[model samples]
Target: MATYDWLFSTLGLEQWCGASGGSAPTSLSDLAAQSRGETGEQAVDIWELPFPSMDALNDACPAFPQSRELTLGLEEGFLDIKDTLSVVLDPITQPLSWALDAALYGILNTPWWIVIPLLLAITWAVSRSWGLLAFVAACILGLAFIDHYDYAMQTLAIIFVCAFICVLFGVPIGIGMSRSDTMQNATIPILDMLQTLPPFVYLIPLIFLFSVTEPKLYGIAIILYAIVPVIRLTNLGIRMVDKNVIEAADAFGMTDRQKLFGVQIPLALPNIMAGVNQTIMMSLAMVVIASLVSAPGLGVLVLRGIRNLELGVGLVAGLGIVLLAVILDRVTKASLARINATHKA
Candidate 1:
């Protein structure tokens, strides 16, 4: 007999408990029965330990019996509302899809020669460090030589788009948070939830909300996962600006906007850039996981390797990701250094 069968029978829940045919099978007996192909009826496992009677518990708590019903109702409610949500969200989010597609297409279609030189030029302009420039050049060449350039570029395109959007939106939000205590209080918990939620969990609701083919599915996930650092850092940077500097700006007859742009933003540039660096790194980390939702990149190859159990493919793609991470990290840090130098001057 199942461990809880007697309790259920005593409580008049035998009908609900599936114990009528005989004494209900214990969990182990049920499994063994199934394995032996003797499954006329399956046994249900009920929580009975430390409880005197099922009826007592049920009478004491009607909610426990209704929990499954409540869950089903919630699921139905979400399904009913999902279409309404899509109607509202699609138009607003279309631009993200366009931006991501354009970036991916531009990178993939452009000649390697043109693309490589353009990247090198940008690296030189930002860092002005020949050593760093050479390292970036070498890394790109190596990725290309290994035929991982396309995958690398796809990953780069996604990171570039997502990270830019993060900075573009995150900075303003951070500035607002810095200016208003209420806004900060309102936003911090949301940011904390996003940062602490499991990375894979970000995709679950998104998968239901958008088709696998839509770039925005992964785009939204990437932004949500990576945006926290930039927002926090930007807020911290602006708030940390010296009061004396603000007073000087006011004394010089600077307007609020002027003080913010000329005095505060420049001073806050280091922290903002640091946030950008972290955002980029986080975006890179999500690339592989994002591939599950049709995000193309080295992540796709990594996924391929895992699914196929090909060690060489996974390891090589992983190495490509590491290389990309290093290149991005060095370039952003170098730019931050330049900003600090100018701020000091």
Candidate 2:
């Protein structure tokens, strides 16, 4: 603020906005309308949006790629992405979608008597620990008792699906990066951009390319946002393996493939698992933001509570998310611990 004030006062740059010599009757209004994208009649004044200097931006990187595919993707689907996605991904997305739609429908239509125990039992069973089971159950029942079950389910659905996909996609990439310096260097910048970006920022360009209706819209956002840790950690894990062990494998006259699979990757499992844990946590965090674009979850409830000023609803739903996070974190950590311990012993 002080620097801006200094600049405004010292340079007399305020004249650009026309306080003394440039002020016009409808200058601000015209600027506002243009900013708002209002032509003859579109939107009202919205001057807060940033204006990209087209020539200057293009000058920096003159050979900008044409976005015809991007535009077509938005309009229909990019190179039959919908059909391709449907054929390749529908089997997985469909079931989860079914589960979510079923869960939501069940929550809104069915009695609390059914929802609470089901969420509790399922969470406990997955964690495979009595204490974690009880804790998760308590969290679920507490959320339900407070009437936050619907939002909780919405969040859970996204987390489950996105986390699964993240691990599925990330592990292979991590493995590849670990094996090749070229791959690692190539991928690091892309991952950096994904991980360092603000959670909400992921939604912007995505919004231009896809509407709220497509399941893949938020799904892609969730994966991209959560994928960084797994890939990095997987690479790190593999790289961090004992040189002695790798040499020992080499002494056996093993190939690089055998060494990686038999020694490096096994040793790296703990780090990879930790990465998966982080990925899941990140996926949960993104799901909440993704709800802004219609990715359902406990986030939707939080949003609802915010929009309607339903304090209790938001509080209970938020608590459900905390409970979910704890269960996931603990189970994943414990699993990794057991694997590491067994390896050591």
Candidate 3:
């Protein structure tokens, strides 16, 4: 007999399972019914605890009962507000949907020959490193050879769009934070919460806020999850600007705006670039988890592998992500090095 069976019977709750007939529960169904209080039977003493517990007055209360009611309540509450939220956010997010779709479609449909050369040219222009260019070219060609070119491109498109949006807004917010200690104090806590929260946690509210079919659903999640680094680093970069340099600019009769653009930003470029690098890396890490909400990329195949227990598929997809990550990391770091070199020169 299950340990809880006696507790139920003693409380006169056995009737809940139709066991008031005085026959012991004969099957799991009886136990289930008894547990659910669904057998049209009433407990003789409904106030009695079903499980053992110390007197609440004499000892610390035991762990709270695990219940699904809270989850149900949240779902209901979200549903109640979902429509209002959708109406307000849809207009703002619709453009993001268009941008993401266009990028993905263009990248996926473009020929390899054209895409490869263009990417190599960009890499060379940024880093001017033939070795880095060759490495990127090989990575792209390898992905294509393995039939993951489309998936790789899809992942790249999402990253490109999301990262651009992150930098677009994040830098300004960082600048604002640097200018106001009150703003920094107020915003740091929020950034801490966002950064420390599990990547999967980002999807929970987003899933309820928007439909899975919408690109902004995952796009928003990616941005929120990956944006913290850039913001924090940007603020740090600006704040770290040498005071002497600012004074020199001031001596030269530069205005606040001029000093910021000419002195602070130029000096802070390296840190800002580092922040961008970290943001890109974080975005890539989230791509797989974001797939749960219908974001596509190499992550889809990874999910497929896990669902179907396909070792080769998961491994190959994982390798593809690693290659993509390495390529991005190398190129960004190379560009950062180039920027540092230019500053030194």
Evaluated at residue 233, the lDDT of candidate 1 is 98
Clash pairs, model 2 backbone = 151-298, 154-297, 155-297, 155-298
Model 3 Cα lDDT, one tens digit per residue, 35-92: 8876525453656534443222111111222245467788899889989998999899
Candidate 2 residue lDDT tens string, 147-216: 6666676676677777877888899999999889999999999999998989788787666555567666
TM-score between model 2 and native:
0.67
lDDT of each: 0.87, 0.71, 0.84
Whole-structure CA lDDT of model 2: 0.71
Of the pair 1 and 3, which is ahead by TM-score? 1
- Rank all candidate structures by their TM-score, best first, as comma-separated numbers: 1, 3, 2
RMSD of each: 5.6, 10.8, 7.5
Top-TM-score structure, candidate number = 1
Winner on lDDT between 1 and 3 is 1
Instruction: Score residue 330 of candidate 1 by CA lDDT.
Output: 100
Q: Which stretches of candidate 3 lie over 4 Å from their true place?
A: 1-73
